[model samples]
Target: MTTVPAVSPAPSAAPAAGSPAEAAAPRRRRFPAWLAVVPLLAFTALSFGVPALAMLNGAFTAKDPSGGASHYTTANMTASLGGAYLTALTGSVKLSAVSAVIAAVLGLLLGQAVVTSRHQTLREAVLTASGVLANFGGVPLAFAFVATLGNAGVLTTHLHLADHGWSLYSFWGLVITYLYFLIPLMVLTVVPALDGLRAQWREAAQNNGATTFQYWRHVALPVLTPSLLGGFVLLFGSAFAAYATAAAMVGSSVPLVTLQIADAISGNVLIGQENVALALSLDMVLVAGLVMAVYLPLQRRSARWLD
Candidate 1:
């Protein structure tokens, strides 16, 4: 039998004119990528970089106690490195650490509740209320708590606890107030991390005879640990550097570095020491830096998960 001749394969066509490669090769150079950096450079110079440098300079300079002009010196830095400064800085760090822990724990629980709740309306209401109240910081929150928990507060009178052992001005009271705001913040920051957990893993854990606590302990906590730590660090920074809330709550009775700085700057001190105020601001920076020491690691690790 005669077989038909095999057909020849068609030749491949050339790429279309001005294909991506060709187009990219002859592209006109409009602007360098560095052009995009100008606005950020301007902002950094004007807002953050300049101010930070100024503060750095101020930290080194000693102010004249007799109301004269302050000048640059190493004395301020040297004196600030002494015992009194270390004590205040340490106290600030301790207070911040406590506040961060309280905030993060409360926030984690609140986020879990909001995320897992069956009641949509209730969950929405809680989130809406939390959002509104989250922005309520500083003096406003302090007064809100004071009005309700003060010696003559509504609860105090109603509960017949007029002389409640806890005063609004006490250290524990400050922690509570910091927590009131901190919990909501944690809810906001952590909801995403909690939500990022794959539902299938949870279901798998459950199917494998894992209890709810077991699933969380084994599967969830490990994945979310970085984010949780980051949130805690953020809260620590916020509570550590917070000024107005503590100031409005207790004034100088329990002096914070921020309050101490305010006293010096406003010229309300017995010694009229502006240099000390500058030094305190520097101490605040160190406290923030220490928090970053913890923060940077979690932040770096968290980025890998995002990828």
Candidate 2:
């Protein structure tokens, strides 16, 4: 032990903050180094911003179909919110709200089945079918529903339900039609969120003697809140913007926003047709804008969760 002199303790490495060069190292920017966003910015400004601004301006300006000069006023907006328009607007919001609830509940169950089932093939097939049906709205879906449930259709006539014949041109019928698309949409929106759940968490919860409800309450539900809200917004927007489906299904019996808008434009309404049409479009924009106001923040928060 005494054969060699004790070696001096190795000098400790200098701390990073102690070195000027290390301390002065430039931090990398969070954004990508190679991305060129100027084109995207320009495109958005031209395509979306310009059109939106123009629409807002047109909403304020009064233009008569008689070739009179345009003047800014609140008359158009006030007329746009008339009783009929208000009724349609309320109908749309209420129907959409109901559809969203129905779709989300059914969709969550479907998503759970798809994710947890052992029969992957069957689940995949069902998912594919749901997707196809979700996009299969417009005139085609209306025809399909009419052919199945209309008075002259096979089911209605053969089953002797003539006394209680279901009219395709009714609000209830529209709700059913909307559900057809909305349910599948919910399945698609929610499946990914369910699939993203970690098996390990469930296992850990079980190992710790947690019940099924406890696991869902403490873990799954919180994680799913964002997706649930986002899906509701998506369903509402889809139902709100839908024109062809509602047009074909109801065919002027029920005055939805889209239906009213269509009538104002080309339904032979001689009174302020162009201006009223513009007003209808503006009304739809306001409703859509309200949904978007809720949508954007939910989307941003969801993105943070993913990150």
* Index of the highest-TM-score prediction: 1
lDDT of 2: 0.81
* Candidate 2 Cα deviation (angstroms), residue 217: 2.7
**Model 1 CA lDDT for position 277:** 74
- The per-candidate count of clashes, in order, stands at 0, 0
Poorest lDDT segment (10 consecutive residues) of candidate 1 = 79-88
Candidate with top lDDT is 2
Q: Report lDDT (CA) for all predictions.
A: 0.79, 0.81
lDDT of 1 by residue, 1-307 (tens): 9999999999977667877756677667699889999999998889978877877887788767678777888776676556555665666777788889888888998899889888999778877877777778988887888788877778767886655476777777788888887888888889889889889999999899999999888778878888898898788878888888888888876646777678768888546566667877877887678767877887787666556
- Kindly list the per-residue Cα lDDT of model 2 for residues 1-307, writing each as its tens digit: 5687789999987667758877777887697745688789899999989977877777778765588888888876787788787788788788788878888888898889888999989789979988897898899988898897776778778886667756656777788888898899999999899988899989999999999999998878778878988888889889888899888767767777777777777755555555666776788788888888987887777666556
Worst 10 residues of 2 by lDDT: 267-276
TM-score result, candidate 1 = 0.83
Residue runs of model 2 more than 4 Å from their true location after superposition: 1-35, 64-67, 162-165, 295-307
Q: How close is each model in CA RMSD to the real structure? A: 6.6, 7.9
